[model samples]
Target: MRRAFFYGWVIVATLFVVNFATHATGNMNLGLFVIPMSDEIGISRGLFGWLTTSRTLAAGLASIVIGRLVDRFGARILIPASALITGLGVIAIGSATNVVQLFVLFAVIGFGGLSPQGGGLLTSVPVAKWFVRKRGTAMAVTSMGLALGATTFVPVTQFLIGAVGWRRAWFYLGIISMTMIVPTALTFLRRQPEDMGLRPDGDADSRLGSGAAQRSEAADEAVWTLGTALSTRAFWMLTAALALGGFAAGGGVHRIPYWIDSGFDHDLVSLSISVHAASAATVMLAVGILLDRVPARFVAAGPFAGFSIAIVIMLSADSNTDMFASAVIWGMSAGTGIVSQPYLWASYFGRSFLGTIRGVTMPTILVATSLGAPAMGYVFDFRGSYDLAWQVVVAIYAAAFLIMVSVSPPRLGRPLAD
Candidate 1:
């Protein structure tokens, strides 16, 4: 029976790998194409930024709805369908002839590809529901997909763009996304371990020992409602902090090439992205270990501080060494920032309504990021430098830090009420 829990973890790890692959494939493909697409479509890079904004907006809006759907149905139904839609959208993007077509195709992709509420939500919520004792570690392992995807695919997509045109690269990627995700999702993504006649961690007798006994106690707790969570000051503070962090991170990340355009080489620019992903992965792993043991506010502050320092360095740096430093600092912060929000959500709200709560919170934050992306591009196009943009991002991060510091966890004894 103990082996059953390990099998569940094995499933979680497998899904994480798949999730990471798809995300990396999409992001790296888009980054590689952004400049070429602008040139080919005869649109300003600022205007082209709408492609991402459209995707993010659609995904954000879809999150809560998808979360409800997951609760009503199951991941087995949603994950494969989302993957197929994402693949189809990728194919459509490859076939697009004009800016209008590109926008429409990417919107479809955004709806399918960018719905974190669907894939990650489906994976993590179920896993969290099952494993009480090791929930933090499990979530961290699953979230690693985001970092792994970015690190592995950035270089590959860069190479693909160099070898074939971006269109052909997208075409090949579409085929790959469809072939891989469809089958694996169908086979492995069950609604719960109980569907297989096993508990979350596969303990046939989870109520046996004091250490293992906590599992039943956690499982018996009431799930939080969206309304009750919203009523808490902690929720508002977390949402504000997350939104500000998103704005800052999105603004800088979407404009990485603009910084490179100032005087850096393409390889160096790509390396910055890779470093950012790598650092984020490392930080997330560290935070995963700390999340259960430490206060949530400190975890939130660590990333914001890292981001602030990185931005300051980036704004000051004129050389490769400085850029490298900037990447490491910012990358680590970005990683921690990404993982910490979800950790906080679980910490503050509990696992029952995680999907719905996250669904609601994610869109608001992503929309901020969506707006930030194009706005930063416009800043570059208008101001001809990322100098002003970096300063703005630094301020945003500062605001997020302040918000986090002011917030505290909800009182432990109250039952979550709608």
Candidate 2:
């Protein structure tokens, strides 16, 4: 019997919550902890910034193993386990007395929870596997969690730090992480639609059985394995483009600190994060539809171009008006970037081996990302300004934009259609 509603949408919703909860602990909110923790612990900004670097580096290395597990066992086991580990790790961070403790916990438990599958990678892959025609829309919806998490958590963390202490704030947020993520993930997530006897996009099975020709066509759909995909020019170019984008994206870790240094009120700095996230959330649905309709390369280029311009605006800004305007532009661009990378991976290579394909790229992307924030912090430490760091990020964005525009999907076998 045909089910009245698609189960894939349920999968999308589950991953949405996963994205939301996991990102609440992500580096975007690190600025909230940076000043307070560094002040209390007497660590320099450059040294404290290594927490993000450690987390990303560990997550990148773990992605090599986790990616294959996701492909083989699915996210059902991995995501919840990661969340559980993440929750305990985050709570442990509350009691940390030194840089070493923070580094070890964040790197191991935090990275274990969020990388390869949880943070954005695993959540996106399952959604991609569940839909083809609707892949872009599903991805757009899933990515809303990322925006929402930032929009809510930045201010909430800011408020919590003010009302209580940063340590207690960490405890509360960690509790929330486990409460929101672990139970739902265990209850709802499944490997793919096929495991439940459903086809991608909820297409009627009868369509494929209509004739011999259709059966042949279905059998001929392109399948790109990790080994073969790595051999293609598209793979390397896309990897370079995404890795550069990852590095640029990490600049968020210092955004709050930069604003505060620029003499903005603390509340105003937090508000800027909300504005950026809200703008990204608002544009994401439209970007998703555009991704489905537009050529993949053009859609991929939009974020890089937007980031370049946005950073330039931010560097020159001296007023509150200019700051918020920069945030809006970055938000719009970031929304597209969040959706485009995974969409490109699945659409370009096909979905069967998405976990493995995305996994292999993790180390390069995470390592590049790991470098960005500390680079900014150390620049500020040594130079007394963030001027040089933003300049470097702008160049990285330009490079990514050029590479992204040049990329075309690799032709493997018969084309896979939406």
Candidate 3:
């Protein structure tokens, strides 16, 4: 049974690695390809920005549906299937001939690639389902995949883009994403601990009993229907905070190159972006450890503070050193923000309905990101700088900080009924 529990951890770890790869591949590739794709296709940066928007929009819309599917069917089917489709979409992007083709292809990729699987949603839900006492730690550890992917894959993709050109990089990434992520998911991921004749948190012999008995016991756990979650003040607060946070973060992602355009060497700019990934990954791991020992709300707040300060520094900085420092701060904060929210949902609501709730939450947050991306790009196109956008982001982060502080953890022992 202990070995079985260990296997569960292994499954989480595998998903973590895959999440890291997919995120790194998805995000970093865009920045690397921006110039080449734009030059080849004769589209403005603002127009090209829609590719990302499409991806986010598709992802946002699909997350809820995918969550419902995962709940009804299981991760064993949903995860691997999404991966395969995502890989095909990546290949499609590589093969795209025109802007329309790219747009349609990436919309498919977004559907396949963008849904909240791989690490945060995918691993967190299943892992949370398996372990209650250790849920925070598990989420933190698994979410580190995002950071790890950013850390490792950014530099690697940077090298690939430089060496093989962006098109080949997409092809290689597509194949690798499919081959690696799909098999690992198929072999390891299980929907619930009960499938293995165990109970959540290894309590097979405890008050919950085993198998059917544990399932019966778990039936009483808080199950918030969609209406109840929507009606709660806490839910709106969380949604607002996360949505603003996404706007700030997404705006920055869209505008990073523009920031670099302000007198820094392009390679140095890429290095700075890579630094953000590395910092995010490191901070995520540290925060994950800390989350295991501290109040999650406090852990969540730390990132907002760091992010706000980083924006201030970025606005003030004129040199590479300042930019690098800003990247570290922002990266760390962003990493924390990404990991903290899912845990927040689990703690505030209930894990049983997490996928569905996250599905609803995801669209709002992603739409903010999608709109922010192109809007920031347009700001740069018109104003020739990202100063105004950054100012707005700073304000948004401040609001997020306040909102996060206002969030009270839900009462843990009772089921919240609609």
Candidate 4:
């Protein structure tokens, strides 16, 4: 008989903790410290922005090597070590006295907090290894920690900054990071279910039969490697769609100023953001379920289309109601990419070599993501309004939609020797 409980759920729970803690420490809660830290340390707001950029760039650079490590040795060694590195880095930031120090510390956080072993591509790869048919549901559940972390930890960080001061606040966050992340990951994480005589989705061996079970344990479930995956047309198409969608999404990300500048009350704008976050969370699970049911290309196309529509609504919007409606759609659209991209990577390429494939694709996606908001900001600087930017963003989304829908899954094959 199948065990009453599968350790795969335990893996999910471990990753959930890792995601929650690393996200809070990595980027989400850093905004809470910007004003206080900047004022006290004598840095401009613009200079402070570079800290995030540094973190993102460092993570992108580290992904290639980390991805290979996760694929080889598994998350067991890397995740805890990443947590330890991130925790210490956060703690060290408490002592930073200059921009150089801050930049170095943020880069440390990037390497530790945002790598495949820690936050961004962290849970997806490990979860993909443990579950196939249930991969969507698994990713959805684990990713919920990100939203929850933002909700819970941002306020906590703000409170700590207020009560203990900014320096002490970093100390506390680091402590929490090390305490929560390292132990859970070390205790529960494993390479794959088969490592422990379990199968993906916790299916009994008898159900798979001998051949399917062997495939599940070996190359059948994971056939493509970095070289073969890179050789496919589908991989390039997906990367292009991801880049376009990221850039398009960035155009709308700074829409708060558009509403505020147009005379919407700050309270209304804040409420709209909440609406967006709620909608995004709901859509994540919805997208996950759809991934299990529909063709991934179709599932992936929905977000690009939804985002385009939301932007079109906002560009012509004249009132609070229109903005709120746009927020709902915008949030829903934002949710699909995070969950689906990783799922499609695994589903199309197979779980075995997912880390390496994701690693290679991550830098491109990260560059697109990092550039999106600033590019929109740049347009607004010259034009004085978001009209031109949003129009361009809508066009970008259209291209992404077409590219996404046209993508075909890659055929399974052995990877060539390096």
Each model's TM-score, in the order given? 0.90, 0.93, 0.91, 0.84
Model 3 spans > 4 angstroms off: 1-5, 113-120, 205-221, 411-418
Worst 10 residues of 2 by lDDT: 206-215
Ranking by TM-score: 2, 3, 1, 4
How do the candidates rank by lDDT, highest first?
2, 4, 3, 1
Superior candidate under TM-score, 3 versus 4: 3
Query: Tens digit of lDDT per residue, candidate 3, span 1-418?
Result: 3444444576568768667667544675467677777887786767777778888888887887876766555577777888888888887777778999988877887787334422245556666666566676677677777776766666677787789877887888888778878888888788766666556666553333344544443463576667678878888887888788777766655545666567777777777888887787777766766766777777786777887798888778889998899889878887787677677777667666777777778888788878777777788788878889888888888888889888886554356432
Candidate lDDT scores, in order, read: 0.71, 0.81, 0.72, 0.75
Every model: Cα RMSD to truth: 3.7, 3.2, 2.9, 4.1
Name the best candidate (by lDDT).
Answer: 2
lDDT of 4 at 139: 87
Those runs of model 1 whose alpha carbons end farther than 4 Å from true positions after fitting are 1-5, 113-120, 202-220, 416-418
The per-prediction tally of clashing pairs is: 1, 1, 1, 0
Q: Compose the digit string of candidate 4's lDDT tens values, residues 134-155.
A: 8998888777666556556656
lDDT of 1 by residue, 160-251 (tens): 77899887878777777777777887887776555455565576633345433344434645557788878788887787887787767666
Q: Which ten-residue region of model 4 has the weakest summed lDDT? A: 113-122
lDDT of 2 by residue, 301-361 (tens): 8998898887888888899998999889989888888888789888888777788888888
Off by over 4 Å in 4: 29-49, 91-97, 113-119, 157-171, 205-215, 219-222, 250-275, 312-324, 377-388, 413-418
lDDT for residue 92 in candidate 1, whole number 0-100:
74
Total clashes for model 4: 0
Candidate 3 at 178: error in angstroms?
Answer: 1.1
